[model samples]
Target: MAAMAPSPGRGAHKHGVIALILCLLVLQREAWGLLCYCEGLCPDHNNFNGTCEAKPNSFCFSAVETVYDVETDQWKEERTYGCLGPDELGLMQCRAYLTKHQRPKNISCCNESDRCNEHLLPQIIHHKPSVAPQGNFLESLLLVTLPLGFVALLAVIMTVWFRYRQRESSMLEYNKPLGLVIGPNDTLSDLIEQSSGSGSGLPLLVQRTIAKQIQLVQSVGKGRYGEVWLGRWRGEKVAVKIFFTTDEASWVRETEIYQTVLLRHENILGFIAADIKGTGSLTQMLLITDYHQLGSLYDYLQNTTLNYFSMIRLSLSTSCGISHLHTEIFGTKGKPAIAHRDIKSKNILVKRNGECCIADFGLAVKYVSENNELDFGNNRKVGTRRYMAPEVLNETINMSCFESLKMADMYSFGLVLWEIVRRCASESGDRYLLADEYQLPYFDCVPPDPSFEDMHEVVCVRGVRPDIPLRWHYNEVLKTMSKVIQECWHANPAARLTALRVKKTLYKFHVSDGTKIV
Candidate 1:
């Protein structure tokens, strides 16, 4: 039988039915597409302001955040909602093994509804870890991270501009050369007082001027944090530490610590300027300070053998710096007690006059007795493993008590003093007996580049300390110095001598030895 042609009305009815079904399917897809409450949204239905629409191949995400109160050791909960971005290009490498996409541990993703995220149970968190990225994550992460970086840059610019403008306005009254000179006083602390009249350091105007005018001459040293360069500003030499963009937190923290009230001290490293320059990926954080040509105490000890007087002066100066940092100055313009968490020979710089100064404050922690607060700034860096105190190695140090931190520093200080004493020449009977060559603390007990577990075994579990030479016992000064080192590195932190006490004892030694203080 031959096929018959359909009537016009029938054909029209069939076409209308097909179009209606297509419209229903489109509406279903629109209903199912993931939409998330924008971040910072209260997640309350009645108070909804806006939402973030997930792009195709994405899901809505919700996260629970718990902010910590370091002072009180308390936590408070917060909520965040957003679209779960698609699998980054680098994440494609893990597709075969993993079914679920990577995200923050706290985040819960769903496609049920925009408010589905609200259904997630709030969990208390001390700290939130970022997603475990895989493959070429850095390359693929630029898409998401670049926007955050741009926002951070804008915030930094606004802060810098505000400081610049405020200082620029005051500059009309009086503009001094590089802030101030050392006048009659010989110390940089005097220079700071002459210029700003505060231990908070030079004015932002002076700092910016110095930063802008600085001419980096040669690379002096390089470390995990950054590179130190010998820079000059108007003929006066300065040390310019060039920090990578990744170390912004550490740089900012050190800058803040250096600017603390009454922070300037004769034995402390002088603060000159801190500036964030450049744009995009080329950003450089410059921390300018007074340059010491003699280099670090570690480098100095390696080449030169110190006499009894030189050792005393170095020890005295270093103790003074540590004491100043550990002591809290009270009043209207007061300074918090700071603990130099890392107190190795490398962190102490040698001045031209045979004195040493504490240089790095990146890992330093501040204690404010008024508020009962101990501020450990957001820095990922930790103390050197080789110099790690027993408490620190075993993870038994009390984070709340400031004294605990100070005691930990004393342990490291003991190690540094050991390094200094090792190179000291002591008079043995008729001839002078030169001390052993410079060696790091626990050199015999542990290997170079030790891990946390390795240090814990040697320092904490095994109960081993740097050996004291038998020759040190005969000389009066050397005997007293050995006792002080023993007291500083006591197995029990509570038994350790305070920085102030150590300073006093070292002063006594200097007086007994009949050597003048440097």
Candidate 2:
């Protein structure tokens, strides 16, 4: 049919409808756009402040954060205001992940009006001079005198406390025995059994005695929690991990984990004592253990190359330590299964007998099978970015399942194995030139210090991993090791090998004169 030409009135009505539709479209666009105030503190000390035009259905947000300043060794508060889209919580978590040292204190969102976030948070004012109060001479005199009296009283109390503490410490040091020796010919195992009788730690008196006699030599290491010192106790060297006052919780946690009944395995770091020592307002949290002169595996690998036998022994010993940690013992003095949340080469120490012992239990969690309970500790989520598992990087880990935690540990253990293999030399002493640098996992794909976003992008989004050298396929043992590493870090968390499985695989591969198992 032929299209009909509209009459004047009909055409006018059609044009009016078209104009109305166009007007509604413009109004809709205006409704979708909203202005919000934006400001932030960046890592480079740059100021970010401006008005942001929010996207469709977005909201304005105000956030306060606490960041640790490496240069000053202090925590600084940061305030930020900005527009956040539908994925608000996820975006905030990503930001937290990117900044390992920066943690969110408060984050609030509002969608009430344009510029709703303006002045939502207080700005940090630096170095504002205090104005002197207007007062007569007599009033100022009274204020000064009262404060002076208070200070004098405080000084007297402090002097008395100091003298008392000095006298007590001297007396205690004189009377206390130097060390707790089960017998003159007793082994470490015998000592451990005697000290911890169906309990997690040594007797309180024993801990105090050990702390009183140790003489600190020098600082051997420093970490986020505090410093580690080399000390001499009863003419024998010991490692003293001294926690800062702020890290009291971590000190307590590590001590509890280390003193787990039946946790004293040869491949695990030996716990000697835990004590709180000091005077007045300043007290030191001390964790005493056996000293390993070779230091951490990371430090040792940097300086020395490992032969095949040494590599297998180190790998097996580490696996054994982790397996024992995961194994739950049964009995009255039984130990619960444990998961080492932050497993890495640096946390593994090399002992004098050329074996590896797992150290640093600050982030460990214990699972009690009897009550079907898991103690998810209150420690901060801190793992080496390069060694994080896919589930952890993506924040999809099942926290309720104890097995999930063990699987994550296995993933990290696999990465540690990769590190060991990179430094391995042939039994015939043939060094692989390309793999000699002792590179960390994903070193080639990410930055020297990969941020959370960088790792998330590579590991979660793109699924990139450390490149396996094609040359490794030529050697049978190296090829087998590569296969094991690949299986350990499978993208699917459920597909990874257990610590026991890894230990058994390495044990079967070993052809050297080492202990049969951990």
Candidate 3:
């Protein structure tokens, strides 16, 4: 019927073949059921694509683990999926194994699926807080380096400034003319120019240093301003005119006149230096100048007599001094014409060479023609009473006329000549005679220290002058001196002899007397 009563062998073979198909189907289902996804990040067990081939008797597993990164010094979470045995399927097993061996932060879950481990395990989602650096590397470097850089820059600047100042100081010291370079032939004017670049005077510091080194030896003279002292500087004698602080104006006036350009001359006292020294209330104002041991004409006349030659030298030298004072040089460096308002024997110094120089310029006045300026100095009446000319005694002189001042000086010069001639004894041609005792012009008419009133009465009111001795007429030199004196002391100032004329007349006499005047 369906298989012709089915042969027993064929039937058995057909049954056996059906059993083999069923067994193959069952075996394929068991093989597929046992398969796991086996994808993991493990380098040792995974392939190059971070996945493993499906394995038997294993399950899909997910693990949330932590590992210490030694280089980063931080805790990191590492996730992996791979086949796990039945014993590893429990959370505690994986957790304990990972915690002990792999240092896992948390255990895993297992599932049997194709890609059950594809998604990460759900956890508390603990995120590693990002660590922020304290400061930028560049900023930290600048903070440390910037201040040191500034300090180094400041040190360099200070060193440069210090060197510049040192160089400037060295130049200044080198420019100063020390006394060692000065020669015997060098004049003070030359020294002033060499030291100051302009012939202005000594530098202020040089003046102070010189003043400080001076040693006062003795008081030489006294005046209304203050005392005159003989001082020594490096064994060189110098006259120190010291004024009381109260009379500082007089000292300043004198110094100013002395410093006039082109004012240095043999007939003018040589200015050395001027300074103010000491501390506070003890300060002393000093004017330093060349000193002469012979003292003033007044002192010399009072102590020593003179011969005819000495007499002529004194009169002519005084005339030369006054004439030079009246001269106004015209050039780049010029001197204004000056008048010695207080000309007297005491204000004239006698040099060792028998010459004279005008001194005591406190009451002097300068006349500048270009500006028509007349400095009528201090108002104080300051001439020796006995030496006042007629115009001066009567206060009737023309103040504006420069010639009137010259005339007044001439009148005083006449009196000085009289004083010089009275002490002279002619020694020419074996005519040896002792000279008369030195006396002031009006010594007979007034007291030794005559008052202004006494002088005014004798000179202006009475029109009296020193009498020329009748004996002078006997000698030619005395007679000529007497004539010059008469012309100089005329009551009318205009009629007075000029200083130049007086000097010329004395020079002529020196020639006529068989003497060659130098």
Candidate 4:
């Protein structure tokens, strides 16, 4: 059939009709394709060869389009399209198509021009779901640990606080008054009452049968052991010497020595009676002796001055007292001789008749036995250092020996004489007058000598020498006294003069006729 030309109106209508029919055919074909594609590529299936495959649990459905380069043979992504239903297998297929064209199958694509082949498709992978742990696990652990840590911290703080409070309480208890009683039933008010009741009254003496008869008037003096009191015994005023409980041993020893010797002389301090009662807390022992109202030689000299005549009397009295101890009696077994270990001024007791007596033979020891001599051992450094002889300072000399005791006593007596002279000079204002005139006074009158840096060097090597003034009142008397002191202070024991010689020399100075001045 040959083609025939139609009129213009007819041609236009016919063209319009043909166009409408073409549009309707395209629409129908598209609808049918869409329905088939949706069914085949459901989420549960893989869209291949017009069949569905089982989908994974984590799959999603979508459509994708891609284009392929003719020369390179590589697919490239164009556009993405989405489906409305859950079709996991179809989604994977779409992802594979997109991957093949550089656009994932899980993503939608645009048109047919972007279509790609199966060889370039990417494999779709399934992943397991991640599980988060239970929310309360860490919270529960923290809740358990935090409270325990806080409790431990609180316990430590409380322990420290308790200890500090306890220590403070103990300190307060210690500082409380001694009278405060500590007992289970005692209260703070009770303690206060007890403390208030204890006043500053004299402590009551523990009475014994012997002390009961001897009535103590008042305390005269106190010593390391106990107090000495002025007491009356059978209408006679006597000094009752009491010993402390702590010094009971010393008291026993002294009693033994006194009983053994049975020392009885006008110069020697007489022991009247010992307490018949044995040891007790307060009245351990008591020794009765005749009391001298003049007190100690030191006190008498300090209080009153002696004229030249009285000084002579005092010297004669003191010499006679010391000589009696050293003198041996005709009837005695070995030797009735004794040595006063301590010969200071205070030990010399002044009597009412200006007579002197030797007292305090506490440190005295008998020189008759070899055992007595050895009792001192290597201990030569006994007695007061100020009155100690130079030979006594030397360790080689044994002080327990009679010869050594005599020498030590001589040295002490020399110091005593010096003390008496110094006191007399001071009372007469001679020391100050001499000091002003000649710029010289007795060595002891000056301030104490400066302390030597090396004490051993000074004591052992450089011996002490007293500085006596040149312009003294009686130059002859001063020279004699200095010579006597020097002889007694000799470094060698053998060189030192004896106590008998010292007594004789002093006697010659002032003693004349039967009468004396003390």
Candidate 5:
């Protein structure tokens, strides 16, 4: 996208917006429905100045995009004005949106009164190569440019300061990953059902509108792809993952996967928005999701030990989530099977309900049955060192086969299960037993932050696995769990149990042992 100069009409637009907002606040809400002014790219092009009534809960939207006219060598805006469909989540989903450049793109939504979205909101565009037209006066610049520049400058400084300090889980040390659309009487799920939702996630337009509305609360954690921060929008806390510009591919891939048809599940990270913001060299690529309290499964296990029942819930919920990812739907709106290549404890988050959901899709692969294609999500598939499967460590993985990747995930899941179970406190008939200190898989065999060579030597060459305590055998449920873990991390990838099989095995314990999966 080429950066260009500021649009000349920007000054007039701001005055129009202030007046527009004031008018919207005073106008009475239409009793029947919203009546929006339809113009430009209206459904009935002939009736450009027509007005249309919006359906219940729907809002008014208007958009303008400056398109380059190749033949004329000039930028011309394509306008869209009408009653837009209901946003996937709720009426509150509507937000102000704009893209910077000489050729700017602007879209806005309003529901305060009839014809509330007649004009797009004012936006400051940066990195324009040319100057504003001579006709735009000094007074116009003073009134519009000065105050907007001050606010923008202050915001940029704060964002940079918070971002510069972003690294690891020290900031959100007490936080956890809260599920977006789950728990008792989840209102967000009902919002999705009531709206004209695709049952996937928020639409791209809605997501982009939301991107600028978020205010970073604090740095949550950092990783290879980017740093994550807790952010707030309209009093609701959300997770904002700001990726390095070089990791742009990962951001796009995760966004695409999250927007997959019918992909919204209780056990997967809840995606809210994906956006690229800022100007020129200072651009930021961001992926926003719902914020849960505890940072990650690894962080949670380290800070808080769990009871046996909580341990089982985490294990079972995780397997169920993975199973949904692995299984492909067949309908027209079906989703292809996805394999989460990096499935370590750090990538799994524990919700307040004592269940785990999978996160991090930068290295995920999707299998499309229609064309028998494998999408590696445009990343150089790099498995985590500590949770590397035997085949992955030895470089024997069949990248061509989708099942090969799924099997590798099982191996990582086994390591995560071990992490969770190690913190579980259980009781035998005759004795009370508490688990040992939380540790990563192969903590004893390899040094901290193991290299590829170190993991290869420890896992593939030595044929080693995480040890199970003899005390685990005393408890019937723990004994069964230990067996399942063994099968998942088998030396042979094909020999490893499928995700569904693992979920079934854990589900059996849930039913017989009087423990709940939720």
Candidate 6:
């Protein structure tokens, strides 16, 4: 038996030609319905003119007119205008000789004007009649293109997923090679051991050591930038101020002011160590100073009760400290007139000897230029809102608006005095016995509400001032205190008493008394 021989190239060519012919036939059939008819050859129903003439309806007017009578169903020689078949009649109403009839269908049946109205009618291509596909061409194209588009989208998603998985795998490999994983139970010291073996642990250990060395015993107070901690440095009690590293410029300025001032006065806090030059970030910088265990004026007021005389002595000590900062001349440059931008009870520290000292130079700025113009443009609002002067809140004027730094300091000093008086007058228990013997009233009169405006408005606008209570009015110590508070809180900064004047006034008040002022 023999196998039949396979066809050669000729047979495949013939098959290809046949397929091409079939495709052409399908395309031709699809396009055949678009052909138009020859001018006068179509049947009346199919032609525009024929349909209008036969119907004699409103739609016939625009069709070409041929004389035809409906009743006889015959052609006539008479000429008529705008008498198209029913299909075109509505379109031909504007042509000459077609007086638009009320009833468009009632046209002449014969020669007589209205005689031909009897019911004349006449009239209107099949190539392939192909129905175009149900959807639009663009929509058909979209349907054919959708599968490829979906495949492309799927490919992109898979590529992204694979890349992400690969990166995660790489990260896991990198982390796993470190051998022993430090668990949550492991302390920082344990992590230091693990990291040290890999040469990455030393830096971490150093940071931890530095942080540990500076222990925060208690939070003394907090300000905008950071908080102050009563800490110990090398076993010596110290005040450690940990400022936010973000405010590097402010920290720099503050450090510069301290370095420039040096540790001169007994009442001013002396700087022992500054972390400004430390290797760590600025935020980690620790400002170390001698810690006065007596705490701040505000804290002292909270802990101890004092008679009017003791209160007066405390006020005098605070005034002396401020006076030293403002008036004590240092070097040929003279004392760089430093203004304690923030002066409240919290910033003043009391010592064991009952002497008060001014601390917290974070907001302090030196008036370097002789003009006394404070470069406050670079500074953020620093003082407590309650203690802020009205002018400070408005910030419309510069430091020059006040005649001297002492004047501004005095304004704050008044508030501090009032706080002292309030706390002293409110004391009870054994402290009250001591207070009573001093010939001081148990309680000083409550001061009027303070305005957060300019000192002028506080004095002139409000016409209100901190008054001495009737009980203490005749008392010499109370009288002196009343006078001092009034002078410190005077309306005009110029009119306000100077820190030096306050110190002098307190000295005279103390010297005249038999009791020793602390």
How high is the CA lDDT of each candidate model? Answer: 0.80, 0.80, 0.75, 0.53, 0.78, 0.56
Which pairs of residues clash in candidate 3, taking residues 3 or more apart in a chain or in different chains? none
Candidate 2 local lDDT, 1-518, one digit each (tens): 99988699988999999999989866674677667777662222344447666666667778777667899976777777777765454364213354556555677777667788876764443321122123345688988999999999999999999999998887466336434454555544456566535545555566677788889999999987889999987578889999989888788889889877888888999888899988888899999998999999999988877766787888889999999999999987788999999999999999988899999888889999899898866776577788899999999998778899999999999999989888876432354434467878887788898999999999999988788876667767778889999999999988999999989998897466542211
Give the lDDT of residue 178 in candidate 6.
57
Ranking by TM-score: 1, 5, 2, 3, 6, 4
Better of 4 and 6 by TM-score: 6
The candidate that wins on lDDT is 1
Over 1-518, each residue of candidate 1 has an lDDT whose tens digit, in order, gives 99988789998999999999989866765655556666553334475566766555566666665555567765456666656556431222111342223232365667665556656554645543242344337767987899999999999999999999987777644445444533442344444556755677776665776688789999999988899999987677899999977788889889989989899888999889888878666888999988999999999999988778889899989999999999999998889999989999999999999899998888889999999998889996789999889988888888889989999999999999999999988875766777788899888877888889989999888899999999898788899999999999999999998888888888775343453322
What count of clashes does model 1 give?
0
Cα error of candidate 5 at position 432, Å:
1.0
Let me know the TM-score candidate 1 reaches against the reference structure: 0.64
Instruction: Identify the superior model by lDDT, candidate 3 or candidate 4.
Output: 3
TM-score versus the correct structure, for each prediction: 0.64, 0.62, 0.61, 0.48, 0.62, 0.49
Cα error, residue 125 of model 6, in Å, equals 56
State how far residue 141 of model 4 sits from its true place (Å).
Answer: 71
Q: Where does the lowest 10-residue lDDT sum fall in candidate 3?
A: 92-101
lDDT of 3: 0.75
Q: Which stretches of candidate 3 lie over 4 Å from their true place?
A: 1-205, 377-379, 427-431, 511-518
The alpha-carbon lDDT assigned to residue 352 of candidate 1 equals 95
Runs in model 4 lying further than 4 Å from the true structure: 1-212, 260-262, 276-281, 330-335, 369-381, 425-461, 470-475, 510-518
Per-residue lDDT of 1-518 in model 6, one digit per residue for the tens?
99988778889999999999988865653443112211232233353542222222222121223343568755333323323333342444333344211112223222222213223333311111122233346677998899889999999999999999998788466456555453646544454456424222223223334345666788877866777888863455668787877766666666555555333466776544456435554337666666888788877886676765667678888887787666535555355657777788878888887788888766666654565555443456466644554445455435664344456677778878876765554222233222222111112322233334543454344645554455445456666777788777666666778888888787776432243321
Q: Against the hidden true structure, what lDDT does model 2 obtain? A: 0.80
TM-score of 3: 0.61
Q: Enumerate residue pairs that collide in model 1.
A: none
Candidate 1 lDDT? 0.80
Error of 2 at 324 (Å): 0.4
